[model samples]
Target chain A: MIDHFALSQAFGLLFASFEPWLWVVPGLLIGLIFGSIPGLQISMAMAVFLPVTFGMDFLQAMLFLTSIFTGGAYGGGVTAILMNIPGSSSSIATAFDGYPMARQGKHNEALGLGLAASVVGAFVGYVLLLLLINPLAALVLKVGPMEMVVVVLWGLTLIATLNDSSLSKGLLAGFFGLMLSQIGMSTTGVMRTSVGNPHLLDGISVVPAMIGIFAASELLRLRGSAYLVQDEAQRDIAFSRILRGVGETFRYPGVLVRGSLIGAVIGAIPGVGSSVANLVSYGEARRTSRTPEIFGKGAPEGVIAAESANSSSEGGSMTALLALGIPGGAATAVLLAAFSFHNIVGGPSFIRNQTEVVYSIILGNLGQVLLLAVIGLLMLRVLGMVVRVPLAYLVPSVLAMCAWGGYGITGTVAGPLTVAAFAALGWLMRRNDYPVAATVIGLLLGRMMEGELVRTLQISNGQPFNYLFERPMALALFVFMLMVLVGAPLLKALRRRKLQQAGR
Target chain B: MTTRFPATHAALLGVVLAISGFILWSAVSASTSLNNLVVVAPVAAVLGVLLPVILASALRKPAREDVGSGAWGDLLLLAGFSAFCLALTHVGFDVATFVFVWAGVVMSGGRGLWQPPLYAAVFTVVLVKGFGSLFPYPMLTLVF
Candidate 1:
């Protein structure tokens, strides 16, 4: 599985040439800007730059596209930490605590911590991917409907952990989100919740709705305020604080390792990429923390977990994309298109014949990760000044951008309308202390969960117990999910016992 | 949080219950399969009715501080964006962009009569031209 000769060739291909660098810089910039914007997306960035790579070679095109992927993945965390808004869906969990930290005048620290985690995640993900590309693809193929259902269930458990006020309320918010997500057409071609609007045939666009709930709602709530940070004295950008935040990422080795692994595995799973990986990792981090209640409030660990997982997923997604020709989500889908355009087919045959080429692409991305760190630091200093902008200017500007961004996605009035509706709904929910994050996550995973469950039912021929009995992996996954559900309290008790012994 | 809403209880419950019931009705009506009728339809009802009750119960009767004058800004937001959406489709992206941002700023209590317009024009041109050059397709075809 470990191909050293190809690795050498890959190194030679990257370090030996200067052609790929031409597009890498621009692609990264586009990714960073697009990814950091509230309503703009990484996929949209890639799609925009996709045509620019037409005349380039396979390696150049991949390098350029992957650089955008790398930059955008980290770029989202910047907005997430500074504003309560996530630049993209993958960074939603990043906002949970990052915004709270920002409220307390820790914006620089949040961005730094996010940057450090993203770099580490991208680094580890690519390194592991380089070594385990084939094995990772093999692992993805083994995942069946039952496994996907378990994954969705695992994702739902995070919702329970996110409710700050009441557990039932959290579950309710999550369930509400699930219902909201189900509004469009179902996998079975059944229209479940469109409310007679033909524009909602695809349901609400996730990014637009996210913009509404997180960005627009916050803007609405802070109507009288001048800026995001309420206190005027703490509004200035501090480089020292940002650097300290970078240094502080080392304090949570446990979060980084766990989050990165979760991201890689979830990201590699076709159709469930960074979107679920970041949220699932954040949920798990919150569930296992010594101070679980502080997660959505201002825990630096939450930002680490979410950003690390999402950034790492890029590498995990690539493992499948290069080895098995599978695009895990929107970003990788574009990558897969690049592969086809270059006449560079993927799958077993490509791996067997073009191992060196695959290695080169991986090597290129690893370098992109390193470049993103240097680039991210400089940009953070400049971008961190957004906190100083007055709300009157900031809010309306964001609103306009958000509306335009939604228009870019749906090309219809419905996109912006959906954003408006979600914004109002989210504002009401927020006012009442509802778990807005849970609602968003639930809406995201609803269709996915339903499709997987439907497939599981069809596979079992309605004999679900029998189906579970037959598959060892499914049974194991079910038990793991059960353990995840039960282990939190057990671990808490164990920690308490340890504390008692130490006190004695 | 205090409830400044005159009919906070009525409004909140009414909205949640009303939306839930509508969605449940739609799901059941559209559902032709057994899985949908048995599993999906029932789940929709529970989600609509049971959960909102849980949420409502989880909350107090509605605090006196629950609503604020800031909430009026929400209406302003809605109205501004609503007009923007319609204007972009009908008037033109450039014209709509200038108007939307200008109106949105003023509505949100932004000062400076000339500054808002200046910002809007520059933003519109930059966005239109920048995106227009990036890809092969026309980004603001309505404007051109």
Candidate 2:
């Protein structure tokens, strides 16, 4: 399982470079800036600076891109922790608890907890990537589309529990979202619901729609309140609150470890990267916690779980890129382009020939963990002031960002128009007591689910027994999901009853 | 207190069902030539289940609850942003953003009108000059 010779070669590559180290901080900063913003992404940052790396050596370019990766992974959590907005799809779950915590006037605490968990996640992922890069990539290869369906179903399961109000309303919201997700042309080349527009041919743009549903939509709801933190007591906040939040992460060692491990493993899988990892990690944390009820209502453990998983997934995603010559997600796809720019082809043979280069990237990312802590702490203080902003100012400014961000995406008025349309729709849904999160999640995963279901059906030749029973891993996961669906609430109820009896 | 009007609930559910039926029809028309009825069947099944539930909830008597914070302000805020989006198509992002955000501040029932527009001006400039110049994405620049 361990390659001593390759390990030494990896260390030698790290020691062989002092100049490449200079690019790490800059790359991390670019990534942090891009990822913290609503519309910008790590891929966008990498693509912009990719030309700058054309003149550099392979090791230098690798360090620079990896720093950006590490920084962006953590940076995505910032907005999620501070506001109800996720900077990207990956941090959507971070907003579930992180935003709630911020709403309690614990914005500094949530940011600190997110930063701490991110560092730990990245560190754990790097160590695991070093130890299990080969096996982990191979393990991900075994997870076929049926397994993906199970994974998506795991997320879908949360839709019912996500809203404690009414299961029927939540289901309706989720189903409606699912219907909307199919508005564009699908992988099999059939347009489901384009609604007579050429732009709709590509379907409702997810980023813009997401911006409207979460940020802009949420602003309308909070408009009645003066500040994000409605309580006057929570107004007098300070930077020291952040340090306390960071310290609190260590209090739940189990949550940290479990989240990191889930993140690394999920991150290693192709196509399904941090986006799914964070949601899955959050679900898992809530599933096993003693206080499962406190999860969406501002649980610190939820923040740690989501942040840690998303951060570790970066290291996990790199495993596929380095070991299998496959891009795990969009960010890794950009990194793959950078590899080609430096005349480096990544594969099993590439790893055999240039193992040291691989190690250098890992070592570089580990150092980024240290740099992130310092830079992140400073950045959090500035971002923490968002709690002070009145809802009146916050709503419009955030709306402008969303509109432009949507414009940045569609490159047209359609972007902002889409946000406006969804804002109205989302507002109505929320007012009707529906779970907007369920709707958002449904939109996020609906297309992928449909595509996978089609592929699975084709592979099995319409034979349910063949496709459903053929894959052991898929079956195991399906069974496990069923157990969770049945067992979790039952166990919680049983425990509650026992506690009630003991009191009597 | 919580209240539910059976008539209102039924009316809303009827509208939802009608819209859903239209989408389901669209979906049926869009299915591939092959055996991929995956989307259509599940959606139909869900709608089938939901039809009865919506009806049942609607036919029931009115229930009571506390009044929510639904005000005209939400509508105003949404309309303001939507208007901004519409303006961006004609006047470009820079101008539309300035007008929309400024209008948003004024309409949000905030006390000071001047400061919001000033802030909106700065935000619009940064979004245009800073983010627009760097990325390869072209911003709508038709100045009206």
Candidate 3:
């Protein structure tokens, strides 16, 4: 499956100039800073810096963006170890045992363990991507419009049902996003929901809406917070102890590998990315452990499980982006926008045609994983200070940047308006415990889903239901989606009910 | 169980349903073609059914206590952010940004007067100058 000639070309493309390598360290630093801060996300950092990438060539831009992706994975674990607060939702499980470790003065070891696991997870994730891309591309090449529609539905349903919230709320959020995406002129040239505005013709500007949803809303929620970290004493760092923790991670090779594997699989699914992967990995690590009693309180295994899975999920998410041109979550959504910015469409055709470019992007990530280890270790002390920045100062400055960046994108008032409107919508959804990420995934895929469904109907001559029997792949995917959306939950509920009955 | 009525939650759900209904109405009204309502119709129909069930479940459960210092505080900040976005075109980018940051610092609990404005001015100049050069279009600015 490996293309030897393309591999050589990818190597030459990446190493041809020092220019491509120039963006890696800076990208890592930017990601470290952004990911280390509580309430700030890697997606926000990617969105803000997206304008800067406009000047670079495609390879250089990918290097810059993926470096940030790599660095942010480890950067998030930093705050989770140092303070009780996780830098983002993906790091929530890291904070569970990591904070307990920190409270016991094992902060250095916790940081090290998380860092090492992240590096390994990222390495393994990209390695799997390198191995799987060609085959996955060939498989995706066989998919017709009917199969595409089923895949989209599978993604949306998985996103809606997999979250911590009630299924109704998640479905509502996803549905809301899908409906919002329909506000523009359709592919068939029919205007539906623009409400007489010309800007709505092209639909909602996805990037600005993303900034508002991921960045601005979080800033709004953080309005009254004094600092990201409450205590000053927790900011200390030691290099040697961290190295020791890094070395210790290899001792639990099984846990580390399992988490990475789990993360990669879940990360490939749309809407469910690192946030769920980390939790699932942590749960599995706990359930399968010899010493389950030590799982929650300052266990190095817990940190490794959470960090490895979260980091590996990045690679898994990239698989979907590279193979299907579908974003698995917010971060990949930004990457998708970047692909559009460069006028390159990502999917089976792109993967097949631009084999060298695809290989280069994957190879570049492997290098980024190594660089993240060095940069992450050296920068931990500096990054720890991010949590000390007053939220008051951070909030408005980022908001202004969002406004400026939005304007920079559309060159019209609609950009900033979408940012503001979506910011409010996102904040409200977050407040009500709705999954904003589900909404975002829905918005990103809605148009594509509709296009595919429309094509399927036209091809089937309006007997779309009858056509399903002919395409086994689509039928199988539809069944799988139903099983995931309904069967898994029903089984879980049944198990719980049985357990309760036994107790009675 | 003791339950408090969540007006905001109910109102937001209502708004979501209304928006979904409108989109569905628009799609049907725009064209009766299968393509128009192909995706939106089924999704909206499901959403229309699901939201009321959520609303009912929420009505039965106790409302979550506000996590922020107060909802009004966040709302005020959100209002300020909206004004800043709206004013970007009407007012110059520099003037609007400066006013927003300056007011934002004070409202977010900066104790002094000179410091907030100094911080705001410095922030506005750097952001405008840096971003102004980066963007292709000429931005309206009072102070460079």
Candidate 4:
């Protein structure tokens, strides 16, 4: 079952590619800076620098980008911990406990724990990519349209678990996002709601919309703030303490294992990213914890759970991308495009035909994880200094970057304008306490769901109920969805009743 | 105990429901071909929009006080800003961008007239001339 020759070749290629570590380090450093900075995403950084890799070998170019991805992901946690602001959407879950830990004067501990968890989680994900991705790819090859629909629905059900505020609110936001997605053309060769604009033919670009909603809105919110104070402090963190933090993470093996598994599963489902994985894992950890009340109050365990799951999604996500040629998240989508540009065909055949290349990628990812850990620890001392920069200066620079990045998406001013519009909408939604993730979920899943639903209907001759009922996987998914919708509330009620009875 | 729903929530929910109902009605009416508008559209439409609106109306009440102020002004400002940006595209990217940035800075609460003028000039000279040559095309197309 195992091909030793291919594996050896992969390792050889990986080792031989070390000369480009020169470019890799600088690229990672740049990615780290961008990731730590609010409004500058890894994609923007990669896109801006993609031209530099034009003359390099294909594998070298990929290694450089993957290094950036690995570094950027870890970099996002720096701002999240030191400042209240999350540097990226993936880091939002990190902020819940990480920021509180910082305010409580456990800044070094928080940073150490986050970095360690991120590196380990990424390693675990990379291992899965190496060992299981090929087999998974074989399975995915047999998936039909019906199976794809089930996968999409499974991904969408994640929104139910993302927002703890209210199910109705989250669902509503997701549905609204779906509706926004419908503003373009349908797969059926008909325009549903373009309102006669020729530009509407291609549908709204998710990147511009995401940039507008997350980055631009964040800038507007920071507009009137006085200078952002970078919190630079001289805290001596011992090597033993960092090791102990890593040890403490594994001490809660249940949490680590569960979080990793959740990340892997959620990562395999398209459109769901680290954000959803972090939320669900954190929620699950809270649900099962002996001291659930300690969550959101600088619990190191909480921080570990969230960060570990969040990073592990990267691993699970790559599995999906390489195996199915279906990207699990936006970053992976960019990676897919890069693969296409390199003339590397992804999918089930990738494992069989290009096993060496795939294994090389896996090995590269392992190297990236190790590099991120060492680099992150070294930068930890400086990040505390970086976070002290004033919000006033930071805000304008971020806004400018967002404006330029949005414009770069479509090479037009309209992209920036869309960013502004979405910013206003996001701000309003935040004010109303609606979950922004829900809207993004809707936007991401809307078109896929519609197309799948339409195709499923056509196959069954307008008999929707029969199709869902007849298909075993679809039926199971629907049942799973219902259970998820009801599970949280039921558990809460049961817990409350048990407490009431004990008191009486 | 007494329970009262807020008028704002009621109004918002009512609007959402109306919109969903209109879409559903349109879908049903527009179904000339069996494959065109099927049960999925209506089901998804009703489930996604109408259910949420109804749930929102049933579950929560709006606050008595108007929470968000300067609402009308903010909308007007946004509209005006968008219109101005669109208008700037015809004058070429450098000139338009300089004006756009300057105007944005001013509107964001910069006080001095000299600041806008100075920034505009600098942006034209540095950003327009310097950065413009670096990119592939003119920077001011309408993205939509």
Candidate 5:
């Protein structure tokens, strides 16, 4: 599995010129800034800056783009902790506990935990990429729409874990989000709930809606609070606490490693990216935790699980891009575009002839992870200042930024309109004890599930029952989902009944 | 044993079911083909069945009290957001952003007369100019 000669050549290529190293820090900084913003995505950041790489060589461009990928992965978690808003869908789970930590005046520690987990996760992902790049590429080729549907179903199980209050409310919120996702034209050329509007044909834009639901809704609730932290004294950003938080991850080495592995594997899958990986990792961490009850209630393990998985997904996603010429998501798609810009194609052939180049890219990313730890610490200090802004000023200003960002996304008023509408929905859902995160996740997965289900049906000639039997991977995943959905709860009830009988 | 009817929870449930119902109706009415209702219809049906259970569960438990300041305050903030969204196209993102910030600060209990406007102006300029340069499209602005 090890390529010593190529590895040595890779090192030579990287250090041969200081040109690539020069772009790494700047790329990471750009990614962090873009990913931290409410409406901006890491993909968008890369896309906007893709033109900048035109002047540079392929190695410089890859290093720069990958640096952004590394930085944005962690940067997305920053806002998720500082504010309730996740910088991107990938960081959604990070907000599960990170925001609660912020409210309890543990923002510095939460940021630290997230930063550390991200750094470690990315490092692990790259290491795994070095070992399993060939096998991962082969696995991606065998995955069909049936498997994609099952992957989405696995993600949907997260709604079950997300709801702390009413399970029914969580299910309702998630289904509602899925239904809302079907507003546009379907994969099969059928319109569901567009109401004859031309704009709705494209479906609700996820980012703006996400910003509305998470950021705007939380701000509405926070209208009463003077500041983000309830305690005034704890609001200060302490580097020591941040350092302590970093140290805390070593205590839960299991969660860190598990999250990293999950992220790498899931990230390698085409179409299913870090967004789903983080949720699945969070659910797994919650399920296996001794203190499962405190998951969404400011558990540091939750932060580690989420941040680790999301950051590591970058390496996993790179596997698909490098080995199969397939872009796992928008970010990788931009990377692929960058590849073509240099007249280099990504596939088995590219991996075969250019093993050293591949090693160089992976090695460059490993170095980027170290820089992220240092740069990210300073970033956390700067972004932790969001806690100091008064809610009165922060609310409308952020809301306006959401609106502007919404427009920046769709280049139309519909973006802001969706944000407004979803903000109202999110506020009502939150008020009624429903999980807005469930809805958000549902919205993210709904399109993928529907589109893939249709494809599965088409592939099976409208009879998926027989096709299900043929696809063992999909069948296995389905069984696992059932175990998670039914068996876990049934076992829990059995345990409860036995305890009651013993007490009697 | 007496159980209180959770009016608010029930109302929220009703809203959710109504939306689900609309979606279901649209999907079925538009095309009953298996492709269209493949995902949408099943989810809607599940939500329908789940609503009564949710209602029963809500009746069994005490409703969560609204922790927000008041209904009116939340509504006003939401209304302010809506107006800001609309004014972005009509007035300009800059002017709308300024008004929204000023109005939001005031609505959220900021009592200063000059401070809100000054803060709003500075924020709007910085936000508009900053994002305008960043974004590829031209932002509609009455005053730059």
Candidate 6:
């Protein structure tokens, strides 16, 4: 059923890619550094480097990008543990137990467990990618514009579940995102609300907007806080203790498996991304644990679960990207650009056509896991030193990087300005408990929804219901949306009731 | 007893009602024998207006305590920044960016005199040089 020769060829390509490991290592190192710093995200790093990657060979470019991605995922846990701040959105769940562990002088142990679990999780995800690419590609081919709209709507509804306080606020944030997305030109060639500005013709760049919202807003929020070095007591853990902690991770196989599966499923869904996966997995792990009371009070399983799930999301996201050509998240979207540059069109026909290239990506991803784990473990103390960097210096550096990234995208000042605007908006929304993820989902899916809606409308002439009821695929997607909206709340309520009864 | 209608719900409902009324009027005025805006804009408008109201109404209840005005200043600053972004296309990106960064720092309530000037100088230099190198293609200059 499988082409052994093609797989061998893919391995050869991957081995050949190692010849330029000099370039690859630096990219990985840079990604790691960016990922270790609070408020410095991989997407920002990718956006800044996007223009520079224009001249690189396909394999080299992909290796460089994937190295950044893999290393970044692993690196994000560093700050989440050592500091209360998350290095990236994906590491938010890690902060729950990571910071507590660090506070208890188990820094080395926490970091080691995180690195090991990340590697294992990534390995599992890669195996899943190799196994499922072909069948998944077939499924992806069946997705139409209407299906995409439903998917986006479903993703938006998840925000309602994500926010702890108010569903209305979350929905409002999502709608605002949808409205913001309407600022650019639509697929139907009509600009909805650009107010006659010609620069708005292309539409708002999601990268700059996201960077501003997450990174810049974070900096602004941190302005008044007193920045201090991590307590010196945290640095005293021995190597043997750390190793023992890592050994303890395998004892919790259930946590590892559950977290990885959650990561894989969430990463398979376009627009959801690893960050959401990490949070959901961490929450679920906490809920299901026998010692749920130990969850936020330095639980090693919590660190392992969050880090593994976050890292594993890369494999799942790549599977969706290579098999379907649809990017599962922002970072994967950048990878999609790299693929296009290499003339590698990823779609339902990709595995059948460019099988070797697809396999090479899988091998490269596996290579990255090995490289990051080894490097991360060996340099745990040295990497932990990043916490010493003053926020005043860190903040400016991040802002400058974000500004540079914004400028690179549109090659205009408007890009940086757009970043500033979005950053402020993001800060306010975050303050108000509005979910920024919802906005991102809305912005990402808005164009796809518009294109599908217009096409469906055109085909039906005047009857809107014809698109929903006439097409079986569309009908199925609609039903799926209904299930997501109704079922998720009911399930959540039931879980709450069960937990209450257990407490009683 | 707390009524089902919250203040946010009432506000959202009023906004939706107003939006619906405007859409209906616009649709009536714009409809023609050959083409109708009624078919295109009205349905989306009505849905957009009514859906928010219904959602707000369904979920609404009286607040126990006032939520903190945590980021109101940040919201205003963002609005101002959005305005500044609109200004950039007209005034040349360099000038607009300088003003924008400076204004943002000021509006954010930064006290240091050196901070604004320092950031402004850095931004202007980087933006001008960056734009010149990045866009080697024919520049589409915009003026207000």
Off by over 4 Å in 6: A4-23, A30-65, A72-121, A228-361, A376-401, A430-433, A455-485, A488-504, B1-144
Considering TM-score, which of the candidate structures 3 and 5 is the better prediction for this target? Answer: 5
Best by lDDT: 5
For model 3, what is the alpha-carbon lDDT of residue A443?
78
Best by DockQ: 5
TM-scores for every candidate against the unseen true structure: 0.94, 0.93, 0.71, 0.74, 0.96, 0.64
After superposition, the stretches of candidate 4 with alpha carbons farther than 4 Å from their true spots are A1-9, A20-22, A33-59, A72-114, A145-151, A154-171, A227-256, A269-310, A320-357, A377-389, A459-504, B1-64, B67-138, B141-144
lDDT scores for all predictions?
0.80, 0.80, 0.79, 0.65, 0.88, 0.65
> Which stretches in model 5 have alpha-carbon errors above 4 Å?
A482-504, B1-11, B59-69
Deviation of model 3 at A337, angstroms: 15
Candidate 1 lDDT tens digits, A1-504: 678888788788887768877788787888898788765678878887788888999999999999998898888888888777787778989999999999888888999999999999988899889888888888889988888887877887788887767776677677777766767787878878776788888876787788777877777777677777878878878888888999999899999999999988888888888888898899888877878878888999999999899998888888788888878788888988988888888888898898999888888888888889888888988888888988787777777777776676676767677777777777777776777898889888877888887888888998877898788877898888788779757887899899999999
Fnat for each predicted structure, in order: 0.44, 0.50, 0.67, 0.08, 0.73, 0.08
Error of 2 at B86 (Å): 2.1
Q: lDDT by residue for model 3 over A352-425, one digit each (tens)?
A: 89999999999999999998889888886565444456767867877887888678767888888888888888
Off by over 4 Å in 2: A231-233, A488-504, B1-3, B6-19, B32-35, B51-55, B58-70, B142-144
CAPRI-style class, candidate 6: incorrect
Task: Rank the models by TM-score, top first.
Answer: 5, 1, 2, 4, 3, 6
Best candidate, TM-score: 5
How much DockQ does model 5 earn?
0.69
Error of 3 at B84 (Å): 0.4
Which residue pairs of candidate 2 clash?
B1-B65, B1-B66, B2-B64, B2-B65, B2-B66, B3-B63, B3-B64, B3-B65, B4-B63
Evaluated at residue A104, the lDDT of candidate 5 is: 94
Once fitted onto the true fold, the runs of candidate 3 whose alpha carbons sit more than 4 angstroms away are A1-118, A129-134, A162-167, A231-365, A380-384, A479-504, B1-7, B54-69, B136-138
lDDT tens digits, residue span A367-478, model 2: 8888899888887777677888887788788888888777776777778888887777777666656677877787888877888787887788877557889899899888
Model 3 chain A weakest 10-residue run by lDDT: A155-164
The list of candidate 1 runs beyond 4 A from truth reads A494-504, B1-9, B37-39, B48-63, B131-144
Going through the candidates in order, their DockQ values are 0.47, 0.51, 0.56, 0.18, 0.69, 0.12
lDDT by residue (tens digit), candidate 6, A183-276: 5445655434344556666667665776676566765555443332346554464667667767888989999988887777556666555756
User: What TM-score does each prediction get for chain A alone?
Assistant: 0.97, 0.95, 0.63, 0.76, 0.96, 0.70
RMSD of every candidate to native, in Å, equals 2.6, 2.7, 7.0, 6.0, 2.4, 7.7
